[model samples]
Target: MNVPAAPHSVQPVRLRISYRSPESLLQAFTKSVGKGGVSLPSQRPLARGTRFLFELTAEAVAHPVEVLGEVVDVRRSASGEYFLNIKYVPGRSRKGLDAALLKLFEAHRHEKSRRYPRVPVHLKAQGTTQVWSVRDLSRGGAGVELETGELPKDARLGVPVLLELQLDTGRLMLHGAAVWLTGGTSRPKTPPALGVEFGRLGLETLRALDRVLVLDGFPAGPWQAELTFGMDAVGRMP
Candidate 1:
């Protein structure tokens, strides 16, 4: 006879997420709705009926969208990843939330599809003792602006460098290699910029980067595809 699995214990959780823009918030909320409910990664499975308090905010919104939810399902993957499905409680703000979601959906319904290999961004990053401006970013690399005078004398293609980005959540340190440079003798007409391709990133670092990308309206499908490819490449490395 097969033994029954043990029941998960109840654990209350509270989470807060702030989006950079209203459009980003709409994307995330709609995606979650399509998945049946909000899904959050967890280290351990929570029992069904576990309560959750979520505070969602966006830069344009004056007030947070507070919602209470209960865990309706728990799932664990073969890779030991745990996730909880949270069903929202129909509170006083339910109608307003529904209306807002509908408005956002309608507004974007007619928008044309576009591809984003890199998204423009204004972010600060520190390398060694100098600060650089992050002008654009993609899953694989970043374009940073730095004056020719500021560029290190030893800076060249394939030179490894460490950059600490000031993300909204916190600072993220990344290892990268300079792939190209412009605005020097090679390309005098172009603005001074460095193309740095990131090295192998840890899971946490990838997740953090994902959060930033999502807020910047990066398409989820492409991001997921790239992430899977990266993971597969890492797995293949001896």
Candidate 2:
């Protein structure tokens, strides 16, 4: 959920999230939205960068009036429930998330509700000539399975790549740059995953990212999992 426009512009909020995924789904419960903070208990441990879709009540709504927020903290309790602390968008989303939300109400402008299910899809990355596969996809970016080979780490990250995504309903093609790479054959090892940011995104894709990042919950994955944090997408993580 992108932050709604608001008058009192603040800084971008860095929200931590506990998201339900195509795999692990979290049951809903109630807790405090703001004022002080919030927490959750877990029988099992939740990964850092775990994402969740939060439903906000009227009181939880800040100036933006949108209840959506991101989880910042995930702690394990002896009792077992995972504890979560979320910072709202005005503080995190666009950084200026607060100011933008108010703008909506002031303009009497109604933005269409943008929502796209995070359908776990595959992206095949073909370089300006090389070949890769999308481990998964979200709007802002994608997680891709890289070609196995020996290349300088810098070269791998700097490469411009194209992604061909096969959606449940259709196919979407896009381009992005690898900001970071993960997974080395060993530890202090390179993690078996890489972080990618979108080099180019269509309007629908951008909107899709907003909804998935803000509201959708990412459950655990079957493969080696790395909790995708922020907006970067990288998968098949070891």
Cand. 2 Cα-lDDT: 0.39
State the lDDT of candidate 1 residue by residue for 95-206, as single tens digits: 4344444444455556565222454455544444454666666567877876444465556677765555444455565667788877766667666677878889899888
Measured over all alpha carbons after superposition, the RMSD of each candidate to the real structure, in angstroms, is 15.7, 15.5
Q: Which ten residues in a row have the lowest lDDT in candidate 2?
A: 22-31
Question: All candidates' lDDT scores?
Answer: 0.57, 0.39
Model 1 clashing residue pairs (backbone): none
* lDDT tens per residue, model 2, 21-122: 221111111112212234544444444444333432222223221334445666666665556554433322332223332332333333345222232333
Off by over 4 Å in 1: 1-116, 147-150, 216-238
TM-score of each: 0.40, 0.31
